[model samples]
Target: MAKRDIPEINAGSMADIAFLLLIFFLVTTTMDKDQAYIRNIPKKVEIKTEIIEVEQRNVLAIKANNQNQLMVRGEIIADPDKISEKIIEFYNTNRNVNDLTNDFPTYTHPTKNEIEANLKAAEKELESFEEQDAGDALIDYAYSKIDEWDKMKRSLKLFGGNDFPLINSQANIRIEVQTRTQYSLFAKIQTEIEEAIFELRDTEAKRIFGESYGVIKTRYISDEEPIDKGKLDLLDVLYPARIIEVTPKN
Candidate 1:
């Protein structure tokens, strides 16, 4: 008997089917983005300047030990979720009135006149540096000062108040973790700090602009509108997040 011949399988359409599936997935599938904290790196210093001491009142230190214990401002924190509240307190304690006996950071209300005077001084300094052919670093420093004053002026105008309330320049939120501390705890610390700052900014944004901070931030990210930028700048001046994350010590 002759052996039966098998029919050939059709593969001409296999490539088309595979292509369709690929296209479907490419159009419908979603990707997860990596979570991160954005921070600005300090510029390299070219000139030596006198060291200024930061008062203990201005320091809000959060420490994590190898045992995963948390301490904020020298007080042991049993709940990690409460970190944000502590941060809020740190910022709001002396915001309206300063108490000399308290250990919280104090606020400075610079008047319009003071800001204008500083702006003039900064511009004059910048011009003097240009005339003397100062080094690039010095010139840049002068320009930065001028820009800083200019920002303050804008911030004050946007504030629509008699004075621009600013926290101490030396005030900061410091995070210190031990080498054996878990990464999860470190991230939690950062999140809590972020939450606190967001709350402060959001409240201020609503009070001043009749919009939420998140809304302004999202709009700015999408369109880069100058109005939103100015609003953000004003909020930043009011509630600056001066965070310092220290490297884990071995």
Candidate 2:
């Protein structure tokens, strides 16, 4: 009997408000993460690379002339097949110590056999987990190495340690021209080199049962003229793409 002062309920308005909020959120939310890929633009000045520390032969530099024929260092690679062989040999020798992590803490020094045993155990565990493909593992491992290399570069730049665009996979390789006198020639060589690397990465990931990883184009810092090659030493190698003029070292 006391329902005389009851206020009118706004059910329709409440529903409309809820619907509008939902639409607002749906419009604003980002479903997929966006990542920025940096591209270094070349410059027109005397580039001072100052790269004294030589990278371990992990990166196979394939030099090409106007033609895309691959050259290992300076020598013309007679057999293209041998390039992979050389890289594999380098990886076998230059890979980080097997002891990057001490999997077996109990043993101070595990012999080769003992290491094999550990690997077997890992395989057994993987099987039990029904992990049919170990592709993600390879991708993760490759990314970490690449990240480390990026960190190293930032340190050497005398800047606060920052992760720059770096490809660290032993899989990382290089393609260059002997001289920057001809821009068109080097551009062609760069394209061919990228395609070759893309195919190789595809094949290896398929073979190793690892997730596919693509080698992205490295960024260049500035734009430089082909003929303006000013004292371009091996320091240019540190920069994966485009010639850059760093301020003269103090």
- Leading candidate by lDDT: 1
Model 1 TM-score (2 dp): 0.86
After TM-score superposition, what is the CA distance of residue 5 in candidate 2 from its true location, in Å? 58
Model 2, position 96, has a per-residue lDDT of 29
TM-score of each: 0.86, 0.29
Candidate 2 per-residue lDDT over residues 142-168, each given as its tens digit? 555444343333333422233222223
Q: Best by TM-score, which number?
A: 1
Model 1's lDDT to the true fold? 0.92
Residue 23 Cα positional deviation in candidate 1, in Å, after optimal superposition: 5.5
Tens-digit lDDT string for candidate 1 (108-192):
9999999999999999998999999998998988988988889889999988877977998889999999999999999999999
Clashes of each: 0, 13
